[model samples]
Target: MQIQDLLKRTDKLPNVPDVVRELIQLLNDPNAKYSDIAARVSHDQTISLKVLRIVNSAYFGLARKISSIDEATVLLGMDRLKTLVIASGFASSVTKVDGIDLPEFWTESFRVAELSQWFAKRTESVDADEAFTIGIVHNIGRLLLHLTAPDVAHDIQTRVSNRQASRFKAEQDLLGFTSQDAGKALMDMWHFPKALGFAVQQHKRPFADGDPDPLACVLNLACYLNACIRTEREIDLVREGLPMAVIEAAGLSPSIVYELDDAMAVSDGLGHLIH
Candidate 1:
């Protein structure tokens, strides 16, 4: 299929609920007021219940229980709670990934989200909340492909595992586009921020256009480290850490990535917003 066709294939993608769409709109708004957001979320019972559940989940380890959106707002902060609401609200829409283990897929995605935010905080080059939200939703294209073309998607993943080659190449060979291409289309369909669309489109080649986007660079390095945590050997990780290009592009020290080898070795459910 051509890029135009992929961009227009809106009906083939997962159905994002209206609540999630509203949350996305709120998150993308720069001048959005906290009371407006709190009121919007309060009207949606599903989101309100899920938000309370996720915040109270042992993952956050809060000092006191949050019983209302107002309380959650004061405790988690508007920016942090906004991203959390997005994560929790948007998760149910993308759970049906073809040929991928659902639990393991979420586990890895959550790890990448945490690591992306962690890297962003350490670098201070981008908004950590945005990075976290981007990391979690970055691979919606893969889920789109799985839902749209199951057999072809499985074939590409098989080649990725067996040949240890880039999934991007495999996707291009078989489907005329990679997940990033699909991701861009999905981001556009969702009316997300332009930064998210740009990052998703070029995260793998963050420096392709001269100066790199700090957000994309962090996402690239975080995805790389997350993959290594899942698949590569520990000794190999210590001996050959993040490439110089990644460190320079993200303006982070090599030692930070190296030291993370032992620290972030396990996922341990650090990023699971939806249980």
Candidate 2:
């Protein structure tokens, strides 16, 4: 089925919270005050609790507890606060899909989000916080498919698992579009910046054309490094496994991946948010 058809199943597709939708709009507004953002987040009790829980968790290494959205905004800065609120909102919104391990999925997603932020900051290629937000939501398409068409999604995943086809190829052959396409559609539906939708759509082939989105390049590299990190690949293997073209496209030196690898080793605590 087409993405629009899947999206039309509003009863199946999870809805992003209203507050998160509003916060996303604030991301593009330069004049949005931190106080205003904090107040907006406070509007959702569930999201606010999750956001504060994540901020005060060991992942952030905060010395003092943040009891309120206002305190979190003041302590974490607007970008950091925005990232937490967005992450919390998205995570809390989605329901469990059959055949997918929700905890593991979220763990990897958060890992990628952190790694993407690191790459963005290290290479100065994109807005680091925006990179983080994109990373968190990048896999929404996979979840959406499972939610809307479980049998087809499972078949496609099985094909990839059995080495019959790559995930992207299986998705395109079976669904007529890749998860990236669905993700882009979802981003557009949610009114995210067009650039973010482009990044989601082209993350797998960020350099497929003459011009590549820097955010896509950052996300693509982060996914590679996330795989390496998860598999406990040595730094040498990680370096050798990276696509040199992607490295160059992201304007990252070969050595930077080493530093990133080290950083990810300690970021396992981020799972605390989802756990």
RMSD of each: 2.7, 1.7
TM-score of each: 0.87, 0.94
Ten contiguous residues with the weakest lDDT in model 2:
263-272
Q: Which stretches of candidate 2 lie over 4 Å from their true place?
A: none
| Candidate 2 RMSD computed on C-alpha atoms after optimal superposition onto the true structure | 1.7
Tell how far residue 271 is off in model 1, in angstroms.
4.5
lDDT of 2: 0.83
- Clashes per candidate, residues 3 or more apart or on different chains: 0, 0
TM-score of 2: 0.94
Model 1: per-residue lDDT, tens digit, 25-64?
6655678888888888888787788889878878779988
State each model's CA lDDT, in order: 0.76, 0.83
What is candidate 2's lDDT per residue for 202-256, written digit by digit as tens? 9998877678888899899889888888898888887777787787778778777
Model 1 scores a C-alpha lDDT of 0.76
